[model samples]
Target: MHKYVRMAGFFGLSEPPPIPQSLRNPRGFRPFHFAPDDRIICFYLDFWHVANGDHILHPHALMFTHSSTLSNYAKYLSVVPDGQSRRIPWEAWGPSNARWMEGNFDSSYYSYVHGSRFAYKLPSSYDDTGETQIIRMFDFNPYAVRHSAKVVPAENGEEGTDADGLRAYEEDMTSGITHRDVTSPSVVSAGSFFVDDVHSSLPYREVARAVQYAEDFSILIDEANIILLTEDHTMRVHTM
Candidate 1:
């Protein structure tokens, strides 16, 4: 079956005493694997407009792992920029879209696209890696509608850098599949698959308006089963 099961509702979050203003509108869900049997999902909340003349992309993140239930997740705040005269380029001075790299079991790498000028590969967590590794970058061409890029980290010291650095390449998407067509891809595993939302009739569509946005959903790949977080905010488990 294309869809195993569908859940409906919002993934609620408990307010942490005095909630920081940044996590007010938590959106953008990016799911990645932490281990073969574990999953970690990251949600990015925009805090761009709150910065008053401070050139920073003040976004906050909410992380959910196997150790924590959906209702009980950890919140992280971005560090403020050092008060220095060095200016951040205007192209990189706003909120960015983050996506987890598939097959990165160490959870050390992810990509973020800033504006439409550049896309960068950055370490997932500075504390875990102790260094911000800029694996590669693509200078975006505004005139081009879409491009194909791949960043593959060296395996077993193959590319001359340490065993952990990445090598990347980019090319235009000339086959007619535009970037917007694949902005939000499906999350699939060996046993089951998860989709943002299933097709519904007009009567049900009116009720599912709130959960219709793709960014509000995530999928958890459990052993022999799949947990889908539907646009309507409900979670459902389908057995293989």
Candidate 2:
């Protein structure tokens, strides 16, 4: 991770993912499309494990890092293999690179740090002069975890766009593990993903509208309505 940060300070990431026109539902289509906010970064984590009669057993997990680049208005996705310390960006790790290519950790063998979880950094800024910024620290134990960081909208909006604000939106979307079959508790962190209208104090109708097609727990906000989708597959629409 340190090496990648240093490299980012040097060469920096290449082209990022094109900004989408709208927040199309990851599973559906929409007529009115809005381009994605470049300031936001989204991170995703997935884990699955088999259980013995009364004891939990074997676990497998994988994490993906994707964020909107404020500079180029694009998205960069970094795929992380589970239970392993595979350094991202091919150039950082090669034949002689022991730190980056130390191989992934084993699931069965319990450890203090790398158990069966993973996480990645969200973009803070895109200055041409690469100054290092720590996005967030993730402490994941096999059973519990904690995240520490400040989540807020960037103030320098008129300059161009609030890259930090966009990153806030992305972080909100991909904070936890949303299961396909189970409905987990819905949480609305300011910048974390899946914030509903109840906390937002919007009318019920608008909350419904926002969630209708907000894809992957995202909202489309301008001067009108705020659309929100929860991790449990619930949608909420809110009026601005």
Candidate 3:
């Protein structure tokens, strides 16, 4: 298995039915992050992988990369594949290159260091006495694995930048592959795509949650505050 595929096992993924071509190559969406620490870049990846078992995984995937890296990635995505490494030497690119690409990636810090997100979920029937929304706090400091340095190839005759022997160690860290089935876990790190093999972490936990009437139109979050906008154009703010 190519080393990069470790995210499959780390995220508790197994070979399932073929993914539609459109989703296999993800299209990113809705970029947001908990206030206070913008270090953890949270965005929705327009894709989902049917997990190895019987559960619907949340379709949100987080990616952390330099804005320039993201910009080049955008430009590269637009290119029709011709079986060539899209790696452009650092000297050949400039800020403008990334400025024109999808501009969602814009952080240059380690992280807010700590961040949280709020989701207003539809209430389950017959349970009126509860908070229908959830506020999940993520320890984003753990996933900042990339750095500007030369990457050395494996000394044991492996290809360049291929992760070596990380699967066994990472698998052991989780209770049972992953708790990411129907109920999302308090995991800090997650699967597939790319996280530097050298560093992966589980730093997420349920911090706080709240609920509002179905008429609540939208919700947003900042350092220690929650903002709600209703369909009637009235606004409400709550302290976290």
Candidate 1 off by > 4 Å: 5-121, 128-132, 135-240
lDDT of 1 by residue, 102-213 (tens): 2222221133222221122233323333342222322222122232222343444333233334432122133211122123422323322222322211100000001112
> Order of all candidates by lDDT, from best down to worst?
3, 1, 2
Which 10-residue window of candidate 2 scores lowest in summed lDDT? 201-210
Q: Cα RMSD (Å) per model?
A: 22.2, 20.4, 18.3
In model 2, the runs with Cα more than 4 Å from the true position are: 1-37, 53-224, 228-240
Candidate 3 colliding pairs: 37-112, 38-112, 39-111, 39-112, 188-203, 188-204
Clashes of 3: 6
User: What is the C-alpha RMSD, rounded to one decimal, of candidate 3?
Assistant: 18.3
- The TM-score that candidate 1 achieves is 0.17
lDDT tens per residue, model 2, 11-39: 11112234455853666764543233311
Give me the candidate number with maximum lDDT.
3
Candidate 1 lDDT score at position 219: 38
Using all chains and alpha carbons, the TM-scores for the candidates as numbered come to 0.17, 0.19, 0.33
